[model samples]
Target: MGVVNVTPDSFSDGGHWFDTTAAIKHGLGLEAEGADLVDVGGESTRPGASRVDEAEELRRVIPVVRGLASEGVTVSVDTMRARVAEQAVAVGAALVNDVSGGLADPDMVPVVAAAGVPFVVMHWRGFSESMNSRAVYGDVVTEVVEELRARMEAVIDGGVSPEKLVIDPGLGFAKNGVQDLALLAGLPRLGELGRPLLVAASRKRFLGHVLAGEGTPPPPARERDAATAAVSALSAHAGAWAVRVHAVRPTADAVRVARAVEGAA
Candidate 1:
């Protein structure tokens, strides 16, 4: 999966793909870069990010999804709003990538269940505005795994088939640097949730922190491509079902290489 944020405040690529034409171009470019699917978001869920109205979110996303679908691209709508998910699916989104994981909107579970397409549920606490305060965890990995398991049960009870769901560890959301590292180290426990795990650590702040090491300034987003590829390989080896990345071609290449080596072994 590739990341395409059509918002002006996405932490990394804000304002880069806010225009429809530019967003479409970026989506197409991701396709050309070997993305199996492109995950597009109209709202920025970066820490402390403000919410956008429903109409604006729909306006920013639907057209891009339609255009990408027209080109036979697999499109996923990265939204927590049920209304946006319904409209985007109607237009051509094949997946609902909800970072809020059904917590933000009361109607999201039912809408996703009715759609019957793949739903990517990220582990989240409250809305973006307050999630940072919810990051406290006794053991980050175990706690995240437990939280995701609870979410899975809720989603199943809400009528979404377990088979149609995928889980995301939600790398930077509601996590401190130490917590993020612990989660990565314990990803296998997350995989035990009986759902495909989507690790979205590409160009994330945690990766920058890891690379920074000794108080050096973190690498910029564009410069994190190689680091992202390394994380892709790590996640895949740790049994991740997919990785969401900004630079798809390199990560795809890394995944292919890892798979090839695994097969040969």
Candidate 2:
């Protein structure tokens, strides 16, 4: 999966692809770069960002989703809003990549289930403005797993087929640098949820912290591509079904090589 943030405030690439034309072009580029799916998000879920209303979000994303989906690119709407998901799916999006895991909006789970498209439930708490402050956890992996387990049960009970669901650990959402590292180290544990796992560690702040602590301040987003590829390799080796990335080609290549090497071993 490759990320195409149509919002002006995404944590990593905010404002870079907010224009419809630029976003569509970027989506095509990602597809050409070997992304199986392109995730188009209208709102910025970056820590401490303000929320965008449904109308504005729709205006930003539906056309792009429709354009990409019509071109045979699998598009996932990175929204926690049910209305946006429904409209996007109707416009041709094939999946809903909800960062809030259906917690932000009351109608999201039912909407995705009713749409019968693949739904990505990312672990999160509250809105982006408040999530960073809510990062307290006693045994982060256990708590996240249990929380996701409960969410899975809710979605299943709400009528979503298990086959159409995927879980994401949300590497940087509410986690501090140490917690992010812990989640990556414990990636395989999420497999206990009995769902495919999608890891999003691309150019996140924690990786920057890691690089910076090792030497100078971490490089910028574009410069973090190699580290992102390394993270993709690690996640794929640990059995992640997919990795959400900004730089698709490198991560795609790294994952392929990692899988091939591991399989040969």
Candidate 3:
């Protein structure tokens, strides 16, 4: 999966594709680079970011989703709004990648259930503004896995088909580097959730911290693509069903190598 953030404040590549035409072209570019699916998100979920009004979000997202879908792209609408998800699906979004895992919006599960599209339920603590404060966990892996399981059950109970659900650990949403690394190491435990795993560790803060040694500043977001590709390779090797990334080609190459190793195994 390739990421197309259509907001002005996404952590990475925000303003780059804020334009409808540019966003569509970028999605096609990702497809050409070997992305199986392209994810379009309007809201900026970066830490400490404030929520954009629903109208603005719709304005930023729908046109791009429609444009990409028109060109035969398998698009996923990355949103927490039920109305947005519903409209995007109607406009040809094949999946709903809800960062809040249906928690932020009351109608999100119902909308996804009604649409009958695949849903990416991500592990989340709260809204971006207050999320970091809620990152506390006894054992990050155990807690995340348990929480994700509960969410999956809730979503299933809410009328969504079990087979249509996928799970994401949400590497940087509310987690610090230690916790994020723990989750990566614990991918096998996450796989026990009985659903496909979507690893979305592209250009996240944790990777930046890892790349930057202690007492040093990390590189800019765009410069983290190689690190993201490394995480993608590791995640795929560890049985991740897919990886959402900003740079598709390098990660795609790494994933192909991992898949080849898996085939050999």
Question: Which sequence of candidate numbers ranks them by TM-score, best first?
Answer: 3, 1, 2
Candidate 1: residue pairs that collide: none
**Which segments of candidate 2 are over 4 A away from where they belong?**
none
- Expressed as tens digits, the lDDT of each residue in 1-265 for candidate 3 is 9999998889888899999999999999999999999999999999999999999999999999999999999999999999999999999999999999999999999999999999999999999999899889899999999999999999999999999999999998889889999999999999999999999988988888889999889899999999999999999878899999999999988878878888898
Estimate TM-scores for all models. 0.97, 0.97, 0.98
Candidate 2: pairs in clash: none
lDDT of 2 by residue, 1-265 (tens): 9999998887788999988989999999999999999999999887888988889999999989988998899999999889999999999998899988888888988898889999888888778788888899999999999988988888888889999889999888888989999999998899888899999999988888877776678777677888899999999998899999999989988988988898899
Q: How many backbone clashes does candidate 1 have?
A: 0
Reference-based lDDT, residue 209, model 1 = 81
lDDT order, best first, reads: 3, 1, 2
The number of residue pairs in model 2 that clash at the backbone is: 0
Task: Please list the C-alpha lDDT of all candidates, in the order they appear.
Answer: 0.91, 0.90, 0.94
Model 1 Cα lDDT, one tens digit per residue, 33-91: 89989999999988898999999999999999999999999999999999999999998
Off by over 4 Å in 1: none
Candidate 2 local lDDT, residue 204: 88
Best by lDDT: 3
